[model samples]
Target: MVFAHAPVAIAPLALISLGGLFWLWQKAETPFQSMQIGLGFGLGYFGTGVSWLISSIYLYAEMNLVLSVLAVLCFILFLTLYFILAGWLVARLKTAQRQGFNWVVVMPAVWVFAEWVRATLFGGFPFLMTGNTHLMTWLDGYAPVFGVLGVSWAVAITAGILLWLVQSRAWVGASLVLAVLWLTGASLKNVEWVTPKEKPVEVALLQGNVPQDDKWLSKEFLPTLKRYVGLTKQNLDADIVVWPETAVPAYYDVVERGALRSFIRDAQLLNTDILLGVITRDDSHRDYYNAIVNAHNPEQQYQKKHLVPFSEFFPFSSVLQPLSELFNIPFSEFTPGADDQAPMTLGGHPVGLSVCYEMAFGEELIDSARQADFLITVSNDAWFAHTLEPAQQVQDVQMRALELGREIARSTNTGYTIIVGTNGQLKAEIPPYETGVLRGEVQPYEGETPFVQWRQWPILILLLGVMLLLVWLKLQARPSRKTTAED
Candidate 1:
């Protein structure tokens, strides 16, 4: 299953995805054929994209099976609208020759623009971003050099080459592009960007495997806490122990009974630091944050900057609150953290922390990695059980490590917990739906990556400028209307 471990190889699948739409558009023979093609592409892309929603709702949350399947289909169909627009744009821009000026440039631009649109529009579900799927393939070495945007660019270029081959039957050109990807991947396999200097730090990640339905119930609270604590106690020799998102269920202000603090103090007694996910509230009790708080130190707190749509907070809750809840939203009211939260420190090393869903945004995670020695994430995938979603999501996290040159320690409540190296290899991992802890040695590096220092914004601006400059030159080259008519 490409959807399982080898998710990074799915970029080529997009060719099948997009090409199928183009064929459909050819059959339609309509005025807005390009637009129709785009819609077709979107349908295929998102139809399969949101299939994980079935697992999330039915298997994980135990929702009614029929409604859960319907919900997943509806979500996928809804997300398909964006792909339609993407296809429309590409088709609409075709020159009189039935071919665009440069598909290489146009394809990447359109796809990147589409992905960006998908990430921001309608509260933005940026999951399964095409860029994330490139992790396992050596095509990802371009990540550290160009970020996910670069891999996205390469993917677009490959699409363009394929399109060109289709139009002109130029097999040589297509073969060359494929060869380049192969060679690049081969070269990257040998490249050692991060050297492990310090002795490996042993980490223990606790997966309580708490059922989503009972996780927040009063009766289940003690058992849930005990599950995590008991697991950590078993791994006391670990240098760092982590629990997945909201391992502590209630808001801290209400439940800060000092019980967790006492446990943290004991962990400190063991010379280990426990990084936990908990709900935190401000003095006014108005701002409740989805946060990662350290038990050993009161000073360190990592609040989640990116909150999930509908689940965290309805985009327009006042108007849609009733409708959102009617659909069984997980967390309908959560506060977002400030963008510039500092990386948390544990055992004297900077650990850049991001909550679940935050890892999907490559730029933000990479920027955070710039300052931190390693990357850490806490998640409760009790939302998406035994689906391609978690696998795809993990690949995204792995790419973040590769792009930013940081070690990743990801702990999930319902499994798929993994340890990834700077090169994006799964050095260690725990499977989905399993109750266990993953322990491994991680050597945090000190050197900075180009992506770590200079983020995606600079590269994007440069690309935009070049495209704009090209447009300006093309306008200048066009013959004057009067002269052309006289000729």
Candidate 2:
């Protein structure tokens, strides 16, 4: 499972690794033993997969070395609990007579639910979703139809088949099922869901590559602001110019209004719309926001709605206050943007918007993407500190692009700034940790993919329904109670 994501990215490893766990669940003599298997698998999987968290805690959050390790381990252990419970759930199917149904349907369904619960719990750590492994593979075709969870379903089902192949006598049936899945997935690859509009918007994404440590420094503030503005100034000829999240490095009001507006006015005069990130405070100053500023149209800005749990806001505020004191995290009080906030129009094109890690939630962006021509995600991932997190984030953006079948303009501080086409293909990008501008043309797509149209409702409903049906079958097969009882 750890090998499913960067920096390994071998697609087959996702299902193969999961198959091993399914095998263990089959072999366990008791539910507790299955739970033990889950515990061990969870420890190995999330321990290595989420090691980046320690860097975010120790280096960026500036927590003590010992505390950072403790915090990350605690968090990983919490995530592991989900799988531990899932293991117990899978073991419940062990006694069912329809062993084939148990493997083919119930096990994969449980795994899908586990993935969703893991992603949604505690503001979601959506790292290393099993579906994210099939970026360029045939299974990625499922992404457009069912979203990442659907892709996860395809992967999970295959693992179940592998489990059945090893343990059951249904060899030919399993082989045929496997063939149909892959062949159908490959055929779906040729399916086109979105109609691309004729005009392509040339976008200039600016990566200032500012060090996270120096980003808040008073000495570096002015230089960083000037550096981003200078980069934008050099790209005035593009249809749209963008900078990464909080590229302003100050409150929205802190920048000399005249100077900043003057630059925007100059760019507007040349028909360019500049979209950049800055922290902004609402009128009463009681509410602060991590927002995108539409330099050409100040009032038409997008604040981030999906706040990352720990960094942007505490999961349980009253309870986590003490933990905050120890962590000393920044941006802990940001107010989320409105759920129905309007998408911005840049370069005369409707654009879906996300700031920082908001790209992790595909459903949240669907509202913006439904009526938009393309998507934009501005992030500052410098805290990742040369880890695989940035690459993993790029994959998230790619999956979103595929899900919506719309091109994405992703600008980030320090690296992995990229242009993802509607098919989840990397069209263009600049090297991470380098100060540069990635100039590319993204063609605007004008239609909705099925995943965007229905979201995850169909898939979620189907999985839960199957699980309930299996429970009903189990109950029907239960031994009847004897009434010789009158005693």
Which candidate's TM-score is highest?
2
Model 1 clashing residue pairs (backbone):
35-88, 38-84, 38-87, 39-84
Evaluated with lDDT, which candidate comes out highest? 2
Tally clashing residue pairs in candidate 2.
Answer: 1
Runs of candidate 1 with Cα error greater than 4 angstroms are 1-11, 19-31, 54-78, 96-103, 120-124, 166-197, 258-261, 324-331, 462-487
Taking the tens digit of each residue's C-alpha lDDT, what string does model 2 give over 1-487? 8888977898878878888887777678898999999999999999998899988888888898998898889988999998998898888755546666777787788888899998877677777898999888888888988899989999999888988898888999999999999888898878999988978999999999999989988899778988998998899889899989988877787673743766766655668888979888887987889999888777779988988777887778888778887666556678998999888888888888899788988887898999789998999888896987898998999999999889999999998899999889999998988999999999998888899999998888888897788677766666656533443
lDDT comparing candidate 1 with the true structure: 0.72
TM-scores, all candidates, are 0.87, 0.95
Local accuracy by lDDT, each model:
0.72, 0.86
Residue 340 alpha-carbon offset, candidate 1, angstroms? 2.0
Poorly placed runs, candidate 2 (over 4 Å): 96-100, 256-261, 483-487
